[model samples]
Target: MAETLSAPALPSVYRQLLDAIDIGIHVINHEGKSIIYNRKMSEIEDMEKEDVLHKNIMDIFLFNKEEESRLLQALNHGEVHHNAKQVYFNFKGQEITTINDTFPLIYEGKRIGAVEIAKDITRLERLTRENARDKQDARFTFDQIIGDSNAIREVVENARRATRTTSSVLISGETGTGKELFAQSIHNGSERASKPFISQNCAALPDSLIEGILFGSVKGAFTGAADHPGLFEQADGGTLMLDEINSLSAPLQAKLLRALQEKSIRRIGDTKNRSVDVRIIATINEDPAVSLEKNRLREDLYYRLSVVSILVPPLRQRKEDIPVLANHFVNKYNKRFQLNVPGIAKGVQQLFQEYDWPGNVRELEHMVEGAMNLIYYDERIDYTHLPVHVRNKFPSYNDISHAPEALVVPNAPPTKPLQEYMEEVEKVYIEQILKRHSGNVTQAADELGLSRQSLQYRLRKYRLNIRHS
Candidate 1:
């Protein structure tokens, strides 16, 4: 009998197959005690197989009370539960994320324990959170204007103060500056906050149409006239933003001047002038002085509307605000997309600082949003995610080159002093930044790492107007 004992059988192929699996796998008995755990499961739990086997499943691996209850319910009811990319903390206190599928294992028409298969997905979760953050930063807000630069602060302070006035305000800046936003903020901060704040693009409509739209017409005043109230009448006791006021036709300009001077408008084919009480905020992209010299604008109208003139600084002028604007845009896009992008890479930040933003804050916003979407895996955005145009402009510090072709250099004598040449370069860069930040100096200053006061000094020295914020 001692010689007839059969040799111990080798492990079955099924057992070997279970042990070979890469994903964590575990089995619990009917009593909810761990019956078997593969190598992967032991690794995931940071324990030896001998330590986990025979231990209560709820007592060993389930960290949270809710998870323990859920596991018990699944085992008792012979149910299956699946969680895709769930987050957890392990025995070592390190955060772990996984996609898990759990199901009751039944045999011989009787409920056995349950088996759970889990795969680590911690990196995926982190990436998702980063994408969300980038979206959150990209949004537009009154606070998006970043600047401690004195010139920019002065403009913001003035704009904030002007919000309390009912006088017709003029916003003068280069294209891409946020003239309309300033107008809107003033309206929002004024007595007409709750009332309708209407906006009209004077450059987009014909003189007759502009006139008709500004002043209500009688039923038979002209073709298609059905006794509609004009924007001015509708906006009575509120605010009206006139965008591109310099583009107004001569005749329309004259009519507009008359209305502002008289504080009333005469409808077409009407003898009576109706008085309306509406605050006017006008925006002109071109320099008012230049427009006056070209005879494109009437001097009287300019003075009337510019009682509180605000000139917005462009992106290049307030380079200090770039980083702030970039961060803001990143946060905005992160929220919108529900991604967890951490922040811009240091290299990308450097590139942003060096590049000339001709398009201003609007351009920067678009670029940040685009980068968030483009960065599929990495939490941090690098220089590669930026638009080619932006990247191209920012030659590496090691690479020396002239400005891009799109950048124009005024013809200056070659014998110009080094300081004068540098000043010109600075002026161009500032102008480009202003255009990028939509003339928001605070935003530009944040990018350049300069105080608003310092930016103001440079602006004055360069004769750059800092009127809009």
Candidate 2:
């Protein structure tokens, strides 16, 4: 007689097959007790076989309503649920979000049990929401931050040291001082550069929304809420830049301090804690001492977040950097406007240095951009090209002319590439039309007898920046 495999050996083969599947397999008897919970199901629920096997589903999991538990519904009602999403908490207090297909099991024409095939989407749900949000691209690095002043160089050096470790950083500076720029640079230089570099402006959103955004939320946690991961979870293994952190309310500050200390966060209305690994870089637009004294920022939270503090000097303090920043913006707009302007005029440079820039580096950039909108190709930005407000600051600006002298070469021909020559001619012609129409693109396009969009495309193609006269 041939040897035969025993009946006990058959269940082992079936169990191995069930465990091999990626989807969670859960089987429950008519009494709603879990009869078979495969390895995948155990992993999905973060529960062990010993804990779930032979236990009632209700005893292991909490459902908002009996109807919400798909497995139980299948066993009790002989119903089949397909591609249904269920968000519920397990006994261990962990929130489990899954998409499930459940069906009642029938044997000999009698409803006996229920079987559920589940796809765990806890992480995917969070990632989907995170990707949907508008995120700024972290493109700046230490090399891109243009400033030669000692004040700025010292701040940059401290920020560079921050990248070497996973310490919390607090960057304090006035508004428009490029605090976010330094934050992005440090993130790019850190080991977590490859990971998500998430930024949230604490001042932009109200406290109610900010809490959910930073710590995440579960379905039914609030009206019109769904399962989602917070910034901490989304920025796991990376950096989280909180801009204007002092704007956060005091109660939120206490909560933030807890998350930093524990390295874990509890979702809104969640009972369980989720671990996260995130490097935080927070910024404030006032002195830390003033913010604390005014009760705007919590001292305890400040201490926690300021493992490394960096104070960026304002534009007025770092006046030496004004010329370099202006030049950088000029080069940037030169490509955008398709102009070949070499540099700014000396008169304009003198006024820029003399003025107390309340808006800091951002004001300088805007001034450069405004001037670029008014100039022609091959012309340096001059005093007359400066915006009216800048000119008004220096009443005698016209008297101080700094025009670029023509380099007269004996017997040298004015030879250039045909493409360059054509571009220059087209740019000047469009500019003249725009000037005639007071920079109205529609009127300019109609006067030029081209479609509005067509003329607009040409404007961009030739890098024209038209300002209304």
Candidate 3:
């Protein structure tokens, strides 16, 4: 069994315990004599603790510092110095970096000695610089963008031009307008193309989470919070895309603006700011002006972020790109579903052009995906193969030129399931056709290209009152 230590050994044991810690620590009395120099300080200074003991801290640390010694300041003023990063050369002339907190030790409101706690980050600083030098390849290039419409071309040209500079970019468009696609293309075409192109949706998380993710969090910042690097640090020397920027609350917008201006971030629990060379590219679904008026976004932040603004034209405005986008998706899904769909029927192409796609390119992709799933090998996607909701957009005469309201779908994807949307459309179309034929079931069936029996079954299925003429 180990022998128990005597009371006289407690002081030595405490001193050894202090020396075992990785950080440098020391205390100074009223006469500026070292009173609590530890082994870590001796190692950091490359001097023996015995030699520094009973000596003024100023005497032991000789440096041509631009700022006054914080320790001396605290000792004289009987004040406190929080975590401030200080840089200096140690006794061996090696550069030392640390964040220190110093305070005058007081008893009964009377100033006594001063204690200093330091966290040495010299090695971490060096490693960070070295890691930043490593190149990260971007995931997107301009060549991958498929649109050639003049509206899309103009936006693309401006985006490309914006990439040549380091100014922040703001992209705005309706849902499914591919804002992130443009952001990725610009990043890939920029001088920082080889650097990481990280993306995050600002609205995806809560306020506290967004703050912690963007600015990072230090150990003990909160419960279960570790010293984790944020997206800003992770995207150093690269681009970081913040999607749905308007979703960030006003207070968070201010914090983001500060980070943009300072190019540095202080973690949730950290005291010192860490510099990062990250380029920002923010995207929002709403117009900046409108968002500002609604107080959903900060005005100053909007101007600071929209240094180079790019507006992605919605699908309706650039309808000319629909065919190409459709074909591209068709080919993509062909390989995915292992089906050899020869091509789209001309009627289907016409129907696609006639329909005003409110869900934009994303909706089109889903439409094609839905159609492809129904078609077998060697089958051509025709108007009938389209989803019922899409087919319902065409009027009784199969003409939508005069039926603007029928072609108008919501900007967002249908909230209900696809089958429900189809049922509603089928019921409405059957009712419209019945009314068009003056309740003549046979004429309506002929016009719909369905057998009379099928028509009767559909009318019964939808509980529609029909007449036979």
Candidate 4:
């Protein structure tokens, strides 16, 4: 009697398991024909598998010759190919991008068909494109911050070095000096770049709310208490920038000091403490030492937070950077509003170099932006474009009673050449313009209907004292 042969049984969940997969999956026979295809694979190809069963895989799909040849070789060699790039042409005549991994199915040491798994990476590709666009839009770098003065350079150098460390940083600067920008740049350059960076203004919140906000409150902890994580908790594994930190109350300052020292926080109305890992970066308009002496800030907390301190110089001290900053703002607004208002005139540059900018760089930026909006095409900004207060503060060219008047030839035959007299007039006018625009060459050029390069040359020729106006 011949021995009876029994057919091998397939696993009960084998088909169900393939169908449940989220990724597209299919099987191809030795002849390169699709033997089985899951619903996802059929949908990805935009075709019904029933109509394409036993069809040549390459014939139904649109793949590069190189990729097709590689897949065929893999099948022939019974080798697995992971993460193969392939393009699939659907019934709708659309090219679908996909990544596939092919593996040969071996049974009893005999080469069978191959299983192919594919995943659509279109969303991931779109996300990458959007990220590139966002980075381009946010292009404020350390170099973009204008200021060649030694004071400003020192501040920038310290900031750059401090960015490399994980210690707490305290940025001290007057309002409008771009303290927040420095903080953001530090966070961007730090190891926690990918992590969340949160900022909170201590002056903006009340004492009661400050406590609940810094150290999150549990449900029913207060009148409107809803359980919520605080900024410290939310910024775990990242940086938390506290603006106007000196504004925090003395008692609340103690709580903050404790949290910093302990690296943990206790929720309001809860005794349990939750560990938190976050870097604290704080900014104060006033000196931390002075704030501590006044009892407005805790000395212990000030020392702890000021491990790395940076003091941004006021704009008046960095007068040389005025022209650079003004030009930057003009270009910014010109592109923003699509205005054709050309460069600042020589007169405006002279005024900018002379004006005492109390608000520093922030004031200069705003003044430039405001002037761009106020001026029109071919119209150079004159003394009138500047704010009345600024113009009134400077001494006019006609009001030089203390100095001896210019010697006139009276009836003497036109002694000095006309060009020399004209040059003298131009020098005086340019000086007035520089005084009017507060040392901003771009603004001065725009006001005088002259190019920045031309005004710069004239300024150097006249040997004018172009520092703070």
Candidate 5:
């Protein structure tokens, strides 16, 4: 025999692949006995492979109790489940709430077994509780905002002034503009600094769950809801930040107003009212006027919540602060990544100033962090280390230095005034861009290297109605 080769066994290959996966994988035969349980599954369930081998998956994960048998249901009825939530207890009494996607395993036109891919939410639940504890003792204060621009200082002044009183403060800004930082700083600087300071995103939870999270829940509120104290109670005598408050439904708005007026809340499925001495700090991504115009937020609630309003200016409006922020991020990441990075490259600083950060300061931080990851022994961060997305925001260095300015209109109407002719060229330029982008102001603005607000103002001046949607 000149040469001999053998392919890996199918079972061995599958076992290796399943073991490599990060999420738990479980399989059960038609009789509900475990057939393919991987190492990740064992680790997620806090069990051993030997314990789960040949045992029924329901028996192992659900502790010998058949409460809502997903595996059996799939195998017997050829059913499928996608992102279905389930809670079960292991033999060691560890409760795991998982989102599972179960599908029937078919062979030759017959259901052979069922397979399930699950992500254990046990750690997520723990982190959420720990987050509540962390909020009780926040770290970031007003001094940590790291910007000296008048735009930033104006908002900080308003926030600091509002901190003295327990009046409801509304801090409005886009994503990653450090709205939560302002909220926490206000709390820390307030008289209620010693008490708990809880913050929750109103948009994170569904309407049904949102109510219970804010006002709390009784034993029989819905289904599995235990006697839990809501965020309002947790932040009693302190601050409760309801971020993205515009996302709350109309009914919830009424309830929130009632709670604010009475300084009390009634838990779901409970009649007794609980009084809470909590300061409210609300954050909205959009302008309050726009929100009120669209009826996305209630009028009464807005008046109550915006007793002291603070609008954090977007990063683009205050590009002068980019140098300070960039240096701050470099120092922060140098210690984090254990590098001796000196500072940002001058070329990178220019690009950062030129680019419009749609995601605001968070995007800048992420870009810096990404650049740091790519850099190893370099003393200074440079343009080459910039992420592809950030690099793609503008033209290449060669293009910017050499690319010819595009012609607006080839036919020069010599009969008109120079200013009028220039206006015509501008109109034609805007028209073409709007048409190319299907009348999207944001995209057109980005392509033209102008801010969205500036583009909108020009559209009004030119009487162009570019449909944003």
Candidate 6:
């Protein structure tokens, strides 16, 4: 007979499983008493299990109120909270930040208790603050942008006009469309150019921490807190480039709107408001209208931030600029790599213009850099020197003429596993569909027989950074 598993051993197995998890786990009973606290939880909170076990939550944690404790909320109100950011002090007077998913435990249709899974991000918050404090100067100027197409020129003019005033500017475009470049150019041309230019990606942190990072905090605001200046204070009389502004939470948007209107901001838990003279330049990866419809952005804040709006056109719509950008990249890499490569082959140049360039100018630049790295004896970059992804984008890739010595074998069998192979094909197919629809996600989703959200998930999953129509 095989070895039998006993029922009593089940509890031990469950305990082991919980301890093995990477995230913190804390469970409480109906009386708000700690029942199970995993090893990860102890590690995250920097406390021992014995310190928490058999203790009331109120006795162990420093929550402001019973309702403020997510575990208590689940036990009392049967409410579920997902990806909620919580900032609170532990019994040891240390402040902690966590993204929590708390759910009520129900038995026989009656509330019993609650369990919470928490991810610690305190170090991330500290690092973000440190990075913001060490931000560098704006290097790119208006003259550095390569494109001369009417599409680019119009936006350049619009951005230039934005520099004349301190009005908030909203720049919208696809990823790698040079939104930050335009932002830097605008700041360098403005009166504040001599002052600081600090940039932050709003999506980099959760709302709870971003608030502190943006507005700062006093020493007594939270446990382990200190006197710190925020981005607004650091960027006083200068420019603050907030990239991916749509990623900010609703409460943050409201706070930001107030700050913009009042021309002042208050530190977290501080009563006094400090005035700032920072010019705001924000960027969004997609159209603002779509963001509003999706409830990802606030309309009032959009109007406030878009006082001077600029939309940078995608690469496909401005194909005429590809040759100039390509040549610029070639020249750039030549100087850096210390190589004397002549230029891109005529056929490769034609290919670059024909390709959809879902990743835009950034993609073109990377492709050139990749090809330059591969060249040794070649006098010029050619079709054969291109990255595999670029070549695979064309169905007639094999038909293109490459240097005779460039090939030993053709149509080699794929070395990757089947799952990887299928994913590659699927990614390329989705990209082609998006390109065909001119990056209209809804239309592409329809053609692909998928819901818009599902297609969007796949786009992110595959990292297919494409422009929206």
- Tens-place lDDT per residue, model 2, 374-465, is 98755678888877877787888778763223322223236977667666666777887788788987678655544344565688797888
Off by over 4 Å in 6: 1-135, 402-469
lDDT scores of the candidates, listed in order: 0.74, 0.84, 0.79, 0.75, 0.82, 0.85
Backbone clash tally (model 2): 0
Models 1 onward score TM values of 0.55, 0.58, 0.56, 0.57, 0.57, 0.57
Supply candidate 4's per-residue lDDT for 11: 45
Encode model 4's per-residue lDDT on 1-469: one tens digit a residue: 9654434433435666777888888787878777778878777767897756886655454332325544465567766768877654442335566788978877888767778788877557658769855643222357666777788888888888877888999999888888988887788777887777888999997998888888898988878888889988988898899999999888888899999999999989887999999999999987767887898778899899999999987777778888778877876675566454556655667778888788878898888777777886435545666676777776482232232144332232478887787778778878877887899776787666664545666887989879621
Report the Cα lDDT for candidate 6. Answer: 0.85
What TM-score would candidate 5 get against the native?
0.57
Is candidate 3 or 5 superior in lDDT? 5
The residue-by-residue lDDT of candidate 3 on 138-212, one tens digit each, is 445677777889998898888889978999999999899888888988888888888888889998899978999
Output the number of the lDDT-best candidate: 6
Which of candidates 2 and 3 is the stronger one according to TM-score? 2
Q: Candidate 3: which stretches are off by over 4 Å?
A: 1-138, 395-469
Query: What are the runs in model 4 whose C-alpha is more than 4 Å off?
Result: 1-140, 395-469
Worst 10 residues of 5 by lDDT: 397-406
lDDT order, best first, reads: 6, 2, 5, 3, 4, 1
User: Any runs in candidate 5 off by more than 4 Å, and if so which?
Assistant: 1-136, 398-469
lDDT comparison, 5 vs 6, better candidate: 6
- Name the lDDT value of residue 227 in candidate 5: 94
